[model samples]
Target: MTDIATKPDSIIAVERWNTFWGARDLEGMKTVAADDFIQWHATVRKNLTKDEEFDMLVEALKVMQITFKNICLTPMNNDTVLQQCVADIAIEGAGTRNDVPFAMVFHTRGQKITKCEEYMDGMSLPPIEFTPQD
Candidate 1:
């Protein structure tokens, strides 16, 4: 694990994000997020607030065996981190499972994550159309 104080703020933010998800710690996620944090997902149509993202994660964790590996995190600048990972997902929906690729860009403010935009290779049922309101 990389120490936050020793690395750049972007790295710290991404590390915290990974840590919380890896442990499925919803409360720990809140601690590292700004009050107005928002996340956009490639699979989802709408942008999600911090609380909403956590709620989504809870549901996903229940049906999927998700694991992130081969994470390559790069600090795009002082406030942004770009990360790519292979997400091994075993989704038990109607008895189907698959591994997927994932990538994200995280923006940080101080020690908290202000925004995260994620890209995933999967299909969401009902076919969502992304409409950016922000």
Candidate 2:
């Protein structure tokens, strides 16, 4: 893992984002997120706030696990970064699916991520038997 202190705020934010998913560190995810953080799933026409997303993750983890591979991060500016990766999703009963392409643009302010726009093939995700809480 890269040292957060040595990197710029954008880089630190993206690093923590990757760490959160790759390591399933939910608490670590909170540290780099802004209070008003939002994630947009453009393809699915869905949006999630920081708290909503975290709650979804809590439920999702019970039936599936995600790991990232071949991660590439490009700093678009001081406050934005483009991240691309192949995610391996292991669903408890559905079996593991590898090389599912995923991409996101992270917007950050200081050490906190303010927003993320994600792009992925929704159909490629293996079905999991978990219902999100209301």
Candidate 3:
């Protein structure tokens, strides 16, 4: 990972996050995130970091699913951070997570996410991958 505390790279991480999240590729997600990455859901005071986040992500992906659409990024600053563009995500169960906007603040040192704070609604997500088996 390169120093994200610098410009461009911080921006890159923003892109990486959206890509990895959309795919739900655990291994791929790991590559861009810092070993001690931290995420704070603005709605909740609880904080998650390191293995906790990874474990949660893996477990969530097991029954959790989401498709990211119309993802765009707005730079909050030159190197410090940016805001995710508004989007309408199609969640299998909870209906469309529409016009749902999120704010991502990055604390980076390399081309990796050392720490992150994501703001999103806490509405219950529907059972993921509810694809019916024929």
Local distance difference test scores for all models: 0.76, 0.81, 0.65
Off by over 4 Å in 3: 1-7, 87-96, 123-134
User: Candidate 2's residue-wise lDDT over 38-118, tens digit each?
Assistant: 888754557788988788779888888778889998888758999999888788878888898999999999879999998
Look at candidate 3 and tell me the lDDT of residue 62. Answer: 62
Give candidate 1's TM-score. Answer: 0.81
Q: Is candidate 1 or candidate 3 better by TM-score?
A: 1
How do the residues 28-127 of candidate 1 rate in per-residue lDDT, one tens digit apiece?
A: 8889989999998877546898877777777766766667899999888759888998776665643433446788888899878999988985563323
lDDT accuracy of residue 2 in candidate 2: 55
Best by lDDT: 2
How many clashes (backbone N, Cα, C below 3 Å) per candidate?
0, 0, 6
Segments of candidate 2 deviating more than 4 angstroms: 1-6, 128-134
At residue 95, give the lDDT of candidate 3: 64
Model 3 lDDT per residue over 27-93, tens place: 8878878887877755455678767778776765565455555565555553557566555555434
